[model samples]
Target chain A: MDFAEICEEKFDINRYLGLLCHPGCGGTSVFMGTSRCTSKISDKTVKALDYTAYVPMAVKKLKDVCVNARRTCAVGNIVVAHRVGYVPVGEPGLFVGVSAPHRQAAIQCMDLTITAIKAGVPVWKEEVYEDDTRAWTTNAECFWLPKPPTHSTDLPQK
Target chain B: MDFAEICEEKFDINRYLGLLCHPGCGGTSVFMGTSRCTSKISDKTVKALDYTAYVPMAVKKLKDVCVNARRTCAVGNIVVAHRVGYVPVGEPGLFVGVSAPHRQAAIQCMDLTITAIKAGVPVWKEEVYEDDTRAWTTNAECFWLPKPPTHSTDLPQK
Candidate 1:
């Protein structure tokens, strides 16, 4: 059975990897997304990150993604869990694990699983900067929410 | 700092993955090779696998591979540990972890590291079958040793 959850507490990679291991499977692949000290877009130094998710929607999305990955990859087992709360720099924000009878399937399944979660999950993030300022991060894939107009093309050209 | 070792005891994936996590890295990818219940070559069931290696040479090769992976993939940290001795079915025989600023680098680095270890490391394996039979598994990449003759063409066909 697949294991999927949105944790309010610290998520452990060791525990998740162990959960994904199986006797029939020969390989396990894992991906961990951690909170970095610097923001990728703005180059601003980040102290930490605060995450919030629409609990019901997020859980459903995670389950759907895991199911899709399992079907596509034909892996033995999988685990997808994300942390929803204050995550310090250097700590994990997302964790994904997959096991299969072979290495390629496990690795491919894990890659796809994480990509789907990042793109489709109803999760929001606030990047807390070292300067004591915070900004609501906009995800390119979360298209359900309205994004602020950025360029002239976004505005109806007068 | 990077973590690299050839272990005689069972290695834990959780510990290695945690060690590879760093504040500067946003992604961590891991690959684990486990002893399966069945052998890939034969239909025979496997009880366990015994691994032996030239420890000094294996350690040096592992370190070199890690350094090369770091330079090529621009990863923040890496861990490569392989078990030397008996590994039961479903237990890990080799574990590799890589962390980078992005997923692509981490994944790519891990893939390359595992391949290098499997190919060049001075390690050998003996597959113990359930039928009280054992066979020395030949690794394609371990070119330093001579392979046993299999066909008449390998000998002087008169």
Candidate 2:
């Protein structure tokens, strides 16, 4: 079965990847975003990343993104999870896995799903620096546009 | 450190992913091509995929692809390995992982690397069907051609 959830503890890529394996699928594509030690903006040393979300809305939105991807693409199974709270440097904050009858669909499913999440998810992130400072940051995918426009009305057309 | 090798035994995704976790990198992208039970051509159930390669040349070419990617992209560490011999359905036959300062670099690196492998690598595969039939197969990426042209002189310009 497909899986999606918000985890407070660290997430597992192996478990997620395992969920995408099916007898009908010929290819699976996966992407992971981890907390890095260096800040892209300032190049400062990073210690951890703090993530939070409006739980109910975030959960619903996350599932919607996956469902939409399945409908638009020729994919079979999908498993995606996001972590909340503090994610240490070098630790993954997001995991997305997709399975399809062929490689192209699988890869395209991941690409579309990731873009959707960045544009729609309600998750918030704060970068904790080693210099005893912290900054709330937007996902790099849409960082230039202040806080992303609220998704309630900004949702992709069905 | 970067890694590139050909494996007759099952290679570890966890091991390869672990190799990509570095303090300086904010993102790591990974792609795995597994032996699927279904064939896109006839929709037949697959039992296993038997792969063969000129070990010396295949190994050298694989490393060259990775080296070329590292030189061209903003990615940091990379760990890639291809399987030879038989790979059962639902098991990965190829794995590519790359770490970079941001997600874009990591993702693009994987895309470029996969394209290069499918277009240039000399691995051959035979599909074993559950009904006791077998057919030598070419990777789907370039299946329109009878067989991919020899890459002996097809290496990308350095």
In terms of lDDT, the best-performing candidate is: 1
lDDT of 2 by residue, A37-142 (tens): 8775456677998888878888898899998998889987888888999999989898888888777898888889888888788898878888756777766665
Model 2 C-alpha lDDT per residue in residues B12-115, reported as the tens digit of each score: 77788888888778778778888888765455678988888888888888898998898889987988889999999888888888888877888889888888
What is the alpha-carbon lDDT for the whole of candidate 2?
A: 0.80
In Å, residue A76's CA in model 1 sits off its true spot by 0.7
Overall lDDT per candidate, in order of appearance: 0.83, 0.80
Misplaced by over 4 Å in model 2 are A41-43, A140-158, B40-43, B140-158
Clashes of 1: 0
Q: TM-score of model 1 relative to the true fold?
A: 0.89
Q: What is the TM-score of each candidate against the true structure?
A: 0.89, 0.86
In the range B24-131, model 1's lDDT, one tens digit per residue, is 898988899988877766677887888988899989999998988777888999999989999988888999999999988999999999889987777778777777
Q: Report the C-alpha lDDT of model 1 over A1-158, residue by residue, as the tens digit.
A: 69999999988666776788787888999888889997855667888888988888899999999989988887998999988999999888898989899888999999999889978888888887787667677877565766622441212357
Best TM-score among the predictions, by candidate number: 1
TM-score of chain B of 2: 0.86
What local lDDT score does residue B129 receive in model 1, on the 0 to 100 scale? 77
